[model samples]
Target: MADSESGGRPALARRLAAEAVGSMLLAALVVGSGIAAVQLSPDQVGLELVENAAATAAGLFAIILMVGPVSGAHFNPVVSLVDAAFGGLSWRDAAAYLPAQVAGCVAGAVLANLMFDRSAVSIASHHRASGAHLLAEVVATAGLILLIFALARSDRAERAPAAVGAYIGAAYWFTSSTSFANPAITVGRMFSDSFAGIAPASAPAFIAVQVVGGAVGYGLVRLFYPPTVAPGRLVSDPRRQADAPHPSRERSTLR
Candidate 1:
């Protein structure tokens, strides 16, 4: 069972707090570093992108390490949904996580702007809408989800921090949309006018594409790692001495 299940209210609260704080710090890092990069490399767009990506990748690794134990470190709503779908999280808690993630992201963007001495809630002017951009969002989000669950199913969950960070860093350069694969962060980016921000008008398409990507990723997971039993049913290897009978066998025996 998840820690939230066993520990109840206190655990849930702690997890929510971790998600909020972690998401806030992530947005701060993204926007602040983008601002700093632009100031430091004024005319060099590539150099600024390099600086921003590197900072974000490193910051993400650290944040996940710090918060993963608490909230599964899901700063992204799609990730929370996928986790719940896979039985790693309960739907009730997952429902709660979405609002927290979105709210935290918005607050984080405002805080980032304030820290950089800008208006706290300026609407982003960075227009990022195009057919290519929407396609990039889908690919970027799909790849992120696949990477995360692939690690989980393979029992390499411990490597997620480094792997996820690295993937995002690489995606920044490879994807046309600069890999804003996170829905919460995409919304957060709308509140800042820095290099990292996305225009408010462009956010809806990106978010919709991301949701589609998430569904595709989930379908891929089911295809590749088909579950051995129905939801809520346990299965154990018959080779193990303490194994319970298979559900079908148990039902037959009971009958």
Candidate 2:
């Protein structure tokens, strides 16, 4: 049977669909874990931290491995936006991806709340907007984007999927903001009063820092490794430019 969306089968569309669905489910897992952890044992600070970190790590790894090929596994909008800014993705794709991520994150939060038998969790209740916390958010989110783009630009994304997970897991423990690198995720997480939630009021501060950090990371990428235009207008290879396609060839072939 022909698919309704395209009036026939479409592999590219199907792949993108799968990526969106997979990313949503991954976000749900993170929210679910946070809600369950808080509901079951809200006061166990040490234990809850461990559980949350483990759960987030597992979900992140799954997302990267599952959708890495489909959509580059960009579950975070900031990462997608930054990549688009760098000319890695089209503005159209970025436009779609940003809203998809936000919706996925919100859905995850809602699902987590339902599972925990609560309408809302009071996460991020305290210690959200202080100087140190803001700084932590900046540094943590910056590191996350830096690691992702750096690996991708270096042609190592396929090899180091696990590093993304590890980086996030470690950031939770090391950074003061607990590594809320994703604005959408943070907003959704705030809906739940779980270990992962940040107060809704504090969302803007964290977001500001995260944006700054992402820009800094992008600037750094441009500085040490400048981009060049290939003869065919294709992106320049980070490792070498000599083998890039010639734009003239592309035009002649099309014509």
Candidate 3:
């Protein structure tokens, strides 16, 4: 996952571009689907959630499948950071990926806004920072990381697409914060004043908790399932087939 640029690996530019494009599409899926759900379901919050969750989940699966091979389709900064921490990816590569992901998410958010006939950069008005919500973020993020590594170690990387999509979809219901377990997505959500948006004021706490949750997840992963491969080889390894569930293919959905 380093910038080794060897062993049939893609060049660094391709990987970064893939991350950006993948992340951009992911944000669009999230914000766009939420907008559609609001329009389609109106004030029926429950139904709206159902619609939003369904679309995000299904789209996540497709996105991952379409882009996983090129860049592991991380689409989440925490995922990339954790991958690097364990040497599944190089620090250099992971650092570069962070900006690409963030930028892609921002672009995606703008795209969603424009697509929905809204301003290009309206800040979110929804604030979600209750104690319970924060706790949910921790649980949601930790579970996501653990799940990813668990599949990799179990030699079920191929099953990751479905598993990941299913888990995120389920998390949307179980987690109080609706499982915004990804930092890039959290940032993207801030740019939209819609069903899936989070107010900027609450973003800091959410991002902080996500990082903390990531640490907890990696801690647990290290505790129970130590690394089997050497450094620079892991779940996000360019050579490793991208694992993580794709939602709709399973008759499902994550984001």
Candidate 4:
């Protein structure tokens, strides 16, 4: 009853819609900001990065708040997959979220390019794959997964919006690849030849390490926040409230 009603097809449709739109907006913010950063801070690479990182961090926080209620605001494919693995989302729903997220990001890239008076679809020429960059992707993505699930499992999900935004902002400065921790965004960036763009050649390697990073994060979550050893019980245990969204409303956050 209640479970069926809450997670019924109609609800699924709404959630999918929310995921698509939220992801689109997220990509737009990231790519658009990168373009602005380059144009606004020409000849100052450091200043361009600062501007891009700041805008992305702030925009991510707001976007999560806007749609976290609807679809958990999982704008990233890795986040959606990991949430499914943790029993927060159904594998089926998680699977559906993949295409929506990727498509939304692709559309967003086009939108950003058009907004900047550029070609609608331009292949990025930026080649970012390097040994250190790959390693950094692993570190950045693993930390992201750990942060998100840590909040969910520890009943601190309410802080995810701000925390995720802050972490990504910091990562942009720390990670060599600017912490492109989201595969959907990584792909979305492939279509733009602007400041935020990643060459198509580099995307696969980045995405591969991101998956590895996701697995490592899963292990870390189990090690640090073991559900089997919960003193009271797992906060995100579906049996406790089957109809609840994986992280529930509070648990939902995006990067």
Best model per lDDT: 3
Candidate 4 residue spans exceeding 4 A from truth: 1-4, 7-10, 228-255
lDDT minimum window of 10 residues, candidate 3: 246-255
Better of 2 and 4 by lDDT: 4
lDDT of 1: 0.79
TM-score per candidate, chains pooled = 0.86, 0.79, 0.89, 0.88
- Superposition TM-score, candidate 4 onto the true structure: 0.88
Over 156-227, each residue of candidate 2 has an lDDT whose tens digit, in order, gives: 454445887898888889987778887778776766666667777888888888888888777776675555
TM-score of decoy 3: 0.89
Superposed Cα RMSD, model 2: 6.7
- Candidates sorted on TM-score, descending: 3, 4, 1, 2
The list of candidate 3 runs beyond 4 A from truth reads: 1-4, 230-255
lDDT of 3 by residue, 1-255 (tens): 555476646787988898999999999998999999989889999998898888888888888887776787888889898988876678898999999999999999999999999999999999999999999999999999888876766555666777778888889999999999999999999999999999999999999999999999999988988766433222244333233233322111111
lDDT of 4 at 89: 73
In the order shown, the candidates' Cα RMSDs to the true structure are 6.9, 6.7, 5.9, 4.4
**Candidate 3 residue 82 C-alpha distance from true site, Å:** 0.6
Candidate 4: worst-modelled 10 consecutive residues by lDDT: 228-237
Clashes of each: 0, 7, 12, 1
Task: Indicate which candidate wins on TM-score.
Answer: 3
Worst 10 residues of 1 by lDDT: 232-241
Error of 1 at 81 (Å): 0.9
